[model samples]
Target: MFRPLELFIGLRYTRAKRRNHFISFISLVSMAGIALGVMALIVVISVMNGFDNELRTRILGMVSHATIAGVGESVRDWPEVIKKAEANPRVLGAAPYTEREAMLQGQRVAGALVRGILPEQEPKVSEVGKKMVAGELHDLVAGGFGIVLGKELAYKLGVDVGEKIVVYAPEIRATPVGAVPRLKSFTVVGIFEIGMEEFDSGLAIVHLADAQRLYQTDGPDGVRLKLDDMFKALGVARELAGDLGGLYRVRDWMQGHQNFFRAIAMEKRVMFMILSLIVAVAAFNLVSTLVMLVTDKQADIAILRTLGATPGSIMGVFMVQGVFVGVIGILIGVVSGVIMALNLEAVVKWIEHTFGVAFLSPDVYYISDLPSDMHWSDVGLIALLGFVFSLLATIYPAWRAARTEPAAALRYE
Candidate 1:
């Protein structure tokens, strides 16, 4: 159907002067629409990808890849568990931690999740030590009962470094007066900000020994593990659990935060579907353009049929013309989208500086910078979608052109 003769005529018709300027204008509009739609899809999808990556990195910086905990109140043999976890080649580091919910009182009172860590071993599985802004993690001595607070939590409690706060543990003790909550006074030695509300606004850290004494625990509650490949955390956790012989409960980071990540993924998919409508609308415009062109070129089609051109060849000519328009638009959109996505951050900064407007304010948003992460697979899929839509739009008009009768078409002429 797409022989040299048909190809030549199809290419010629695309460039030929049209008697009806409306038909030419409609064709141009269809091409522009496709280009704009494709560009928008690429940019939007890239931005979403960037946000997902950034959030994951920030959250994982505080959360370990996997954890192993005893079924009881505390893991009494935490050191042995760490040694066993270290034997796995995939496990890069391991650390034991104790966690509890507590209320802290300074000038103001607020609830927080209190965690205890060994200053030396904590760095093995998490980045809290490096994230400290005011003091060092090593400042918490065993007997000193020093504490580190999240930046937001510290602000809410109206305290800073060198100040003191009283922590009320959930555990209660019997006294002559009545049952009272176990409580202690801890000196605020440091502050850290993780840029996440979940941690920054409700987390506190203390020395492991101090935590054990205060909480009346035999040892750390669990051992945290860091894997070489975080994405393989589930498999690694499962293998570790199996090796431990059901004596302990093992969980991966995703299990703790699956709902949050799932929401982000669902939003991305919804945005993709919503943006695809723009491309679909643009591709459907091809139907109108080709239909008009077929009506305007009735004489030409009739002449071609009379000259022994097969109906299939006639259909091929119109299909080729429509595809050419789609291809050009897709190519332009792909090139423009790639260039824009690669420099999105710089472009956003420039706009903000020049316009004196902040798209994302640091006070309002944890991540104030515009980020873009383009995936080639997304680009390829969008291009294919455009091409398929364009091709489908050509069928009806091309079929109508192929069926034109020579005698009837030339009767008016």
Candidate 2:
């Protein structure tokens, strides 16, 4: 099939050697810059998306999507509340929970947030049961005075299953000499790992009755609610609270941690905008290249005008040429970027292993490895942006070329 005159001429111009080799080099540089920018954006955005997803799953596995509590400290009738909360279509499960801060003394000392859970009910609302590495959650009998420690927490305390550890509560006990912190010793019966360093290092679980006795409460503090769609936590919580009435109040995961996720979102947006500038700069660099090309092709443009080529056709030629360059760069970038995003975790691990370095640590970041997840929508957006900028860059120079006077151009000849 025959190609359009504009396309054929445009492609030919791209291949034909110009008087100045530097112009050709600049064109090559522009294309490379666009490709590099697109690749970087794809990798960075994918990593951010991966982190967001990992964090949500790990956190929701330990923390509830929503909670129902009383205006006072403890919910007197959590059993009824749990039943009512689970009645909502969006609510999948509900379980009573109590949480308190305490210090553990073993071979080493560490602060811990102790959670109260019913082994049978917990699996319905959280992933704690499934996340256990050793021992069963059901081993925590109501009056057994046993505790389940997170893997990192146990490591910090330097204790293992069946070992004894002293937990000092904030509550005070009257003594002959003076009031002292209430302390009790419990045996570690199980260990769990959720892959979230924060939770792993600072959280522990015990029987609901054990927790209530330790906190000196007759009932749990709240009822944790599991939802089909966690994003709808706020709405579902509100509806559940309305339906329950009385001293019942609702709290969602987003309400407690919106700032953290918001910061991530803001950073992602800022990164996208910043990386886009690199593409914009590359796209606009075509302007200078096209301008020089028009100057060099003055005679050819004049001849074409005399041959009945319209000004629009002249513009089309340059636009097509610039778009061709942009399209190739974007395509190359997309392929490289997708490859990088797909294997970023393995690459990071390899680099770390070879260099004897660690990119993320459980002691600092909440995770121990880098992750990446690519989305085609992001690739499409970046490609569209680069193409638009490249097409726009051709306009001014093409207009200048179309306005050339055949008489003036031929006068010198």
Candidate 3:
């Protein structure tokens, strides 16, 4: 089959050697700019996506996707509530929990959130059990007064499993020495590392019975739930609340951490917009390159027009030329970017080792290593944006070339 006249000529112009080497160089520069911009955008967005995913796993995994509690601050019928929650297809698991703000005193004092959990059921609702660095979850028996410290918290307090620590509640109690803060002593039974500094530094786990005793409650504060689809947490919670009646209140993960994730999403958008400017600038280079090519080929264009080429066909030639530059750049960028993203963690480690530097510190960040997660959807969007920008850049110059007076161009030539 014969190719279209415009496309045939366009592809030729793209591959043909230019009389002005500077024009060829400009085309290469434009292509490089597009490739670099696309590569940067892909790598950065993938890293951001990776961070988002890691946070979800390391932080949210330790927390309940949703919680069901009575309006009175404690769920006396938590077993029934757990049954009700598990009845829902969306609910994966549910476990009773009691949480309170307290101070842990050991070698040093640190503010802590003490969570009361049932050893047998806690693993079903949260990942802390799986993340334990020392001891088993079943060791936390009712009335055992056993406590589990986060790895960082254990480090901070200079305590370990089988060791003892004191938890000071804010509640005041009548002591022999008048009114004083309520305090309890317990032996540490486990140390868990969830890979999140905030959780590992400020959170502790204890037996459900011990927590209830600490809080002076007969039952758990709530039933924490795990869901098959985390994004469906809010909807499922609302449905459960309706099914269970107003006496029960439901809360989902987004309620507590929406702002943090929202900030990350906004930053991603801002970065995209900023980096896209580089692609736009590179696309503009195509306009300049095509314009100079038109100047150099004015007589040739006149000859083509005299040979019965239409204005639209002339425009098509240049548009095709610009698209060639874009397609090549985008293809190269996509391949390189994907490879970089897939190996980013290893690459970052190598850089740190070679340069003798730490890019991310555990104390300063939630995670100590760089991460990357490449989504083909994001790659497709970047490629589309680059192609559109390059296509648009060709419009003005192509239009100018199409409108050239054949006689006048030939006379000048």
Indicate the TM-score of model 2.
Answer: 0.90
Q: lDDT of each structure?
A: 0.93, 0.88, 0.90
lDDT of 2 by residue, 149-204 (tens): 99999999999999999989889988999999988889999999998877889999
Scored against the true structure, residue 350 in model 3 reaches a CA lDDT of 94
Q: Write down the worst ten-residue block by lDDT for model 3.
A: 361-370
Judging by TM-score, tell me the better candidate of 2 and 3: 3
**Candidate 3 Cα errors over 4 Å, as ranges:** 175-177, 361-366
In candidate 2 the C-alpha lDDT for residue 399 amounts to 86
- In terms of TM-score, how similar is model 1 to the real structure? 0.96
lDDT of 2: 0.88
Which candidate order results from sorting by TM-score in descending order? 1, 3, 2
Predicted candidate 1 versus true structure: per-residue lDDT over 351-390, tens digit per residue? 9999999999999998899889999999999899989989
Clashes found in each candidate (C-alpha, N, C closer than 3 A): 0, 0, 0
TM-scores, all candidates, are: 0.96, 0.90, 0.96
- Per-residue lDDT for 99-125 in model 3, tens only? 899999998889999999888888788
